[model samples]
Target: MEQRELGFTKIRLPVVGQGTWQMEEADEAACIDAIRRGIDAGMTHIDTAEMYGAGEVESLVGKAIEGRRDEVFLVSKVLPSNASYAGTLAACERSLERLRTDRLDLYLLHWPGSEPLEETLRAFKDLRAQGKIRHFGVSNFDQAELSRAIALAGPSEIACNQVFYHLLERAIEHRVLPLCERHGIAVVAYSPFGSGRFPAPDSMGGKVLASIAAAHGATPRQVALRFLLRRQPVFVIPKAARAAHALDNAAAGDLRLTSEDLARIDTAFPLGPDRGVLPTL
Candidate 1:
């Protein structure tokens, strides 16, 4: 895998990262092995959240990255309910405790809750100011919300946005993508494979991804991941607790899709309807 600089943050991140949404749901040894596989393959960015398995995933990730901390760009998020300044400060301490780290490379607002945008961005700015986090961002935000967050963050701060984006889910392109492009916000794409919605090598959605995969001798998931990586300024974190699956996601960074393949995939999978939904931070 290769590294890419995060927009404005100046953080060198991997193109394809590992997401630990359910790492602990799998056996411990297997989980650690999968993480090791990802690092061995150069997938250095790992994303997690405080609510994920009630902090079990962060603990496991902490253990996995224990000796290889410098090799990984560790990212975790504070829940929406904890979006306030005081709550965010406490959340950061707890996350650091659970993650067994003193500081986080990136700290994100888990979901967009009902809180005012300014309130949340203030918490992020505070976190950045105190050196609790190297970068701050929002997840599952719509175009308008992301624009607001960017404006609130100002051009001085690196405010990346995380959201669901895949070959089957192109809704981000309609508004969020352009807004991020206008500003310098890099996108952190989660669920790049649609959570296995395009699993079959023979289905329209799956075949479309696989056709692009064959062109690069990659899997459908890899093709789907690469599609997102090549889409503007985006990085993808596809989760897998199995070593083989983790390595496959890492291999996506090694594959390069041609413009023709990119166009084919883009047209075949146009942006879907925007529900104007923002996950509750």
Candidate 2:
């Protein structure tokens, strides 16, 4: 799999990773097997969150990565409601316990919360110092919120911004992406297939993707993920609760699209005007 640096840090991560958003709804053994399959396929950047299934998802991830923890780069998020200094610390500890891991590869504030940003950042710094987490970042933050976060934490300290980015939602390209690029912060694209809104194979955009995927001997899902990775510093985390889907998503890491393919995709799924609207967290 292709790799990119996380922010300005020395840590490099796979271009494609695994997301465990709604995996809790799937069969427990199957979900665990899916994650293990993804890891074996080199999609070792496993992302989960405390908010997911009220921490049950984290426990599942823990089981999936039990003996293979060192082989994966683990990430999790603290809920916005837990963004306060003490809350963030407490939340992380709880996540660590649930994940059955001593340290996280990356930890993120789920989104902008009512708590002071500095307080949360302070907790992140302390966590890093204590070896509780290797790096820290944010998710679903708008340009202004991201800028404030960078100012508070320093550009190099903030690792990445996990956001909603797909053919249908390209608002971040206007400002958030540019800012992240300037600071060398990796843009971790969550829901690269639009969170269950992926176009059907017969749909216009889907047809374009299907054609492109066919040309490359890949799946439309691979085309969508590769589209996000067309940029130099972007990572994608597509969820796959089934082992087959996990393997399929992992293969996208090796699929590269041509310029013509990209042009066609662009025409099919134009980045409509940025209305300054951010996707829901």
Candidate 3:
């Protein structure tokens, strides 16, 4: 797998990591296997959130990286409701306990909420100082909110901005992505396969994707992930609950799409100019 520096930080992450969103207690074994498979394939950046399965996924992540922690670049998020200075600290501690790690590679604010930005940023700074978290960032933040976050935390403090980005959802390209690039914030793209809602291989958009996939002997999922990885400083974390699927997703990092293929994809899925309201879960 290919690695790139995260923002201005020295930390380098695989372009395609592993995402643990809806992983539950019932699927614990499978989830752990999937994560391990991804790690084994060099997809060391593992992302999870305290909100995921009510922290069950973090526990599963802990189990997956038990003996191989050094090889993983772990990331987790705190919910917006717990964004308060004190709450953030408490939430992080709880997440650490669940993840069975002393420190997190990156910690993110799950979304914008009622908490004052300054308060949340203060907690992040404190955590970094205490070595509880190496870096801090935000998820689902729009251009305006991101600018405000940068203003509050300063450019270097915000390591990355995780958002919903894919061929179908190119809204961030209009402003958010450019803004992050200028400020040196890494872009972590979630739902790269449209949260499993991607068009069929025979559909209008899928036909174009299929053609590109055929040319590279890759799956449509891999083609989509390759497109995102080609965008420097951007990383994609697509969820895969099965080891086979995890390996397949990790392999996408090695697939290279041609400029002609990119042009065709762009034509099939035109980028909308509207930097409309950013979507959130």
Which candidate has the top score in lDDT? 2
TM-score to true structure, per model? 0.92, 0.98, 0.98
Give lDDT tens digits, candidate 3, residues 1-281.
88889988968788899988888844778888989989999899999999998988899899999999889999999999999999999999999999999999999999899999899999999999999999999999999999999999976889999999888888888889999899889999998888767978778899988888988889888998888777787999999888999999988988888899888888888887785788655
Best by TM-score: 2
What range of 10 consecutive residues in model 3 has the weakest lDDT sum?
Answer: 272-281
Error of 3 at 184 (Å): 0.6
- All candidates: CA RMSD in angstroms? 2.1, 0.9, 1.1
TM-score of 2: 0.98
lDDT by residue (1-281, candidate 1, tens digit) is 66787877666778988888766678988888898899889888899999999888888888889988877888999898887767888888988998888888888888778667677678777777888788888888787777677677777464588888777677777788877877778888887777756657666767787777776777877777877888557999888788999888888888888889888877777766777654321
Clash counts for all predictions: 4, 0, 0
Clashing pairs in 1: 80-281, 111-281, 112-281, 113-281
Pitting candidate 1 against candidate 2, the one with the higher TM-score is 2
lDDT of each: 0.81, 0.92, 0.90
Candidate number that wins on TM-score, 2 or 3: 2
lDDT score, candidate 2: 0.92
Where is the poorest 10-residue window by lDDT in model 2? 272-281
lDDT of 2 by residue, 155-188 (tens): 5888999999998888889999999999988899
